[model samples]
Target: MMIYTIRASRPDEWRAQRTLRLEALKDPAGSVAFVNTYETEEAFADEVWQQRAETQSFIAEDEVGERVANVAVLVESGEEFEEPQTHLVGVYVRPEFRGGGLAAELLGAAIEWSWELPEKVGRVRLWVHEDNHRAQAFYTRLGFVRTGRTMPFPLDESRTEYEMVLERP
Candidate 1:
């Protein structure tokens, strides 16, 4: 595998971000995990991509400067009863980029950012499609544990998503 660089996303790179995200969303595995379809992905406006860059998005670039993978951490404000939590979403790697440990690197960076908060975040969590054993295995390897909290799929009630969490400890 060729050496690649991982860094925070930049607004100027929104087009590249869109391209990579579309590719990821088109992947077979992405179909279940990602919420976008090919048509919807193609119609996303430039502003959406820009906001993603301005927010907590990270991308892995190849030696030639192509964005091959992306992992974004979106912070969700907690209600009165819950501590502020960080949601890990939009994680994907180019089909060719899989198995190179890029996902781990991207996820590690996201977690590190969450831990940097002045008031520590209670935990980092993500939702994985129940049938996505590959992703479950990857998250497990990264020390995330299943919390047994399940939700119906947004587009398909027949399928369920499992809530998984990784504690700072």
Candidate 2:
């Protein structure tokens, strides 16, 4: 079995972050799973990634020290929510590393980290592409329930991305 070291990504790891994100953008499901395209992200400067790396972006590196998966949570707050909220985003698992517990384990870590956040997060929410049933099922199994709320996908307003939330316990 392959062992993985999952931890928060550092600004210095921007190159690795960019690499993995580009790979994810190349997936067949990328259109629905992610709003960005490889070309767009590829053109971003290193400082952009450095800034993004400051978030609760977690990465999983395999035994050989190769990044195989990634996940992140963004703390959002305003009139839109009662309290500070952790929004799950940027999730990806390399094709070769799918169909296993790695994603779950890494997500659990991010969830645990959310609860530890100084902001006192009330819940963890995520957006899933309307047609991405596989991702929907995975989130459901992790205790997230549909919120019946949706917004127009950024890239294509005609399409939607639904919401799911898991209250912190």
- Give the backbone clash total of model 2: 0
Our model 2 lands, by Cα RMSD against the true structure, at: 1.1
**TM-score: which candidate is best?**
2
Clashes of each: 0, 0
Query: Could you say which candidate leads in lDDT?
Result: 2
Residue pairs in collision within model 1: none
Give the Cα lDDT of each candidate.
0.84, 0.90
- Model 2 lDDT, residue 34, Cα: 93
Q: List candidate 1 stretches off by more than 4 Å.
A: none
lDDT of 2: 0.90
TM-score of 2: 0.95
